[model samples]
Target: MLRTTEQKRKYIQATRSQNYQASLKLEGITTTAQTTQQSKAEILQKYKKYSQPES
Candidate 1:
């Protein structure tokens, strides 16, 4: 089944949050500010790549 745009966005957000949380947990860091910031940047880059309009 195909996912709607909202579903896709939610999925991405959830996955990114999960990954950041896991990273922080594995590193035994209580604060994930830096990691979360970096993850957001990476996620934006990926979205930009895939969301670019076709020529």
Candidate 2:
């Protein structure tokens, strides 16, 4: 329903702003692990192993 250019820009900005509100989200993740000496997949897999329920 956004017919005007200004309205479209406002709608797009509003939608993108919602994505930036990470503190309100449930599962917020960070890329700080990527700066570490460990590889990306290795760190993720380690967390994945700990997150799972034991058999």
How does each model score on lDDT? 0.80, 0.73
Model 1's C-alpha root-mean-square deviation from the true structure amounts to 11.6
Task: Identify the leading candidate in terms of lDDT.
Answer: 1
TM-score of each: 0.49, 0.40
**Lowest lDDT block of 10, candidate 1:** 31-40
lDDT of 2 at 21: 56
Residue runs of model 1 more than 4 Å from their true location after superposition: 31-55
lDDT of 1 by residue, 1-55 (tens): 5379998888889899888888988988786355434577888898899999999
lDDT of 2 by residue, 1-55 (tens): 9999999999998777566555435466543312246888999999999999998
The whole-model C-alpha lDDT of candidate 2 against the native structure comes to 0.73
Query: Residue 45's C-alpha lDDT in candidate 1?
Result: 97
- Residue 4 error for model 1, in Å? 0.5
User: Which stretches in model 2 have alpha-carbon errors above 4 Å?
Assistant: 23-55
